[model samples]
Target: MGEENKIILHGTWASLFSKRVELALKVKGIPYEYVEEDLSNKSPLLLKYNPIHKKVPVLVHNGKPVSESLVILEYIDETWKIGSLILPEDPHERAGVRFWANFIDQHVLLSVAKIWKSTGEEQEKAQEEVLEKMRILEEGMKSTNLEICANDLGLLQILLLTTFGSFKAYEEVLGVKVLVQENTPLLYSCVTSLNELPVVKEICPPHDKLVALLNIYRQNAFKSTTN
Candidate 1:
């Protein structure tokens, strides 16, 4: 492919959404240039690529920009049909993958934010919500034979992997065990397996770095609450 048609990804290392796109590209073995965005002072390139949302995880392919992590994932799957497919061939299985991906974005992610941003009664409520959501997710996984989606790694797996990886930071900051081995064995197993993947191990941010960032966020949240 010509240089103009090559893929370029704009994203931040810490962003779960960005990580999802990164994982997708890595899984598909697509070679792309990675541009890390400083969210505090975003680059002009990021703005040029994603003017509306102006967010990370923008996939620029063939000089065309594709925003939104899930949208980029589907685009990658459709564009590169080699390697492991991110969506199943069957329409129903594809829908299931989409459903779980949406669930992680709409429900699981929102609850995780609440857990870390709030305190006291509000934080406790958010914790309950996260646990409830995890239960539902675990049940969904159980029904689907414990695979992330269908029989192979797909969009849902990428989404959930990033979400759960971020949850490790939140769990430490909030002092809660969201994905316990005893309570959610299958989900825990899924997390373990996903982490062990070579691509994921190489690309996913280090756990200690995530925890340090979360600690800073926790301190700031406390300071704001006190103020």
Candidate 2:
């Protein structure tokens, strides 16, 4: 690919969405530039490029900007057909994979955010809601015997890593063991499977890194509260 058609990704290193996009690009063996953005002080280029969400994981193709991590993933897959595939080829399998990805994004990721950010009785309520959602997710996983992609990592595994990885910071913020083999058997199993895969094992962030970032995030949140 020429520089004129060069791909550039704007994202933060710690963002799950950003990480997913990065992994997709790396799997496709696409050469791209990475721009780390600070959400608090977002770049004018980022704002102009992704005026809709103004979010990270913005993939700039040539001069065209494509926002949304999932969309970028599809684009990367289509643009470069190298290495293992991210999505399944069969139509039914693709739908099933997307279903799981959407489910985790809507339920687990959203619920985790609420559970970690709230306080007092509100926090308790959020935690209860998260547990209910997790139960539902676990039940759903129990019924599925999905096949892995050529990459050895599928949508379900990606979603699982995203959801369970969020809880890696629980000890730092909630001061509790939120996600473990004992606490969340299904999720823990999925995470463990993903970890065994070379691609996922190398790509996923370490729990300690997330914990440190969460501590910083929590400290900043408290300062904002007291201010």
Candidate 3:
């Protein structure tokens, strides 16, 4: 492929959204250059590529920018059709995946953010919400029979992988266990199984490193609040 035709991912290492794009590219066996961005001082390329959000996980394919993690995943799946399909071929199944993926994005992610960024009564409420959401997700996974299959890792699994990876960081900072075996056996199994995938294992940041980062982030958040 020509240089211009090559894929270039602009993302931050600490960002779970960025990791989603990285996982998709690796799973598809797409060769790409990664440009790590410092969110404190984002690169010009990221600004130029994603002027609207100005966020990490901007995928520049053939010099065309695709922003947002879920959008980037779908773009990769459609662009590189030879790899594992991110969505099922059946329309009903695809819709179901999209629905649950949106649920995670909207509900679960917001709850996690609240838990990490709040304290006292607010944090307590967020913690309860997180557990409730996980319970719902656990039941949903059981109903759908979602597992980490080698040949069919759908978009929902990818989203869950990112969510679960971030959950470790939040769990450490918040002093909570969201994915215990007894509470969420199926979802816990899925997380463990996905973490072992070569593509996922290669891209996921170390657990300790992520926890450290979350600690710093929580401290900064607290300082800002008190000040």
RMSD of each: 2.2, 3.0, 1.9
The TM-score obtained by model 1 is: 0.90
Model 1: per-residue Cα lDDT over 1-227, one tens digit each: 57866999999888888998898888888899998889889999899989999998899998899999889989999999888988888887888778877888889778877776777788889888987888898888678653662335687777777878556676777887667677677677777777777888888787799889879978887777789
Q: How far is candidate 3 from the true structure (C-alpha RMSD, Å)?
A: 1.9
Residue 88 of model 1, lDDT score: 81
TM-score of 3: 0.92
What are the clashing pairs of model 2? none
Tens digits of per-residue lDDT for model 2, 1-227: 69777898999978888888877776666788889899999999999999988898899999899888878777776776787677878887788778777777888778777755667787778777777777777666566656532235555655566556556567567754456565567676666566566666666677788778878887776566668
Give the higher-TM-score candidate: 1 or 2: 1
Q: For every model shown, what is its TM-score relative to the native structure?
A: 0.90, 0.83, 0.92
Predicted candidate 3 versus true structure: per-residue lDDT over 99-218, tens digit per residue? 788989999888877776788888888778987898897788668766543435678778878878556666777787656677777677777787777777798888798889889988
Against the reference, the lDDT scores of all candidates come to 0.81, 0.73, 0.81
Best TM-score among the predictions, by candidate number: 3
- Residue 4, model 1: lDDT of 63
lDDT of 3 at 33: 93
Error of 2 at 64 (Å): 1.5
* Model 1 bad stretches (over 4 Å): 144-146, 149-151, 220-227
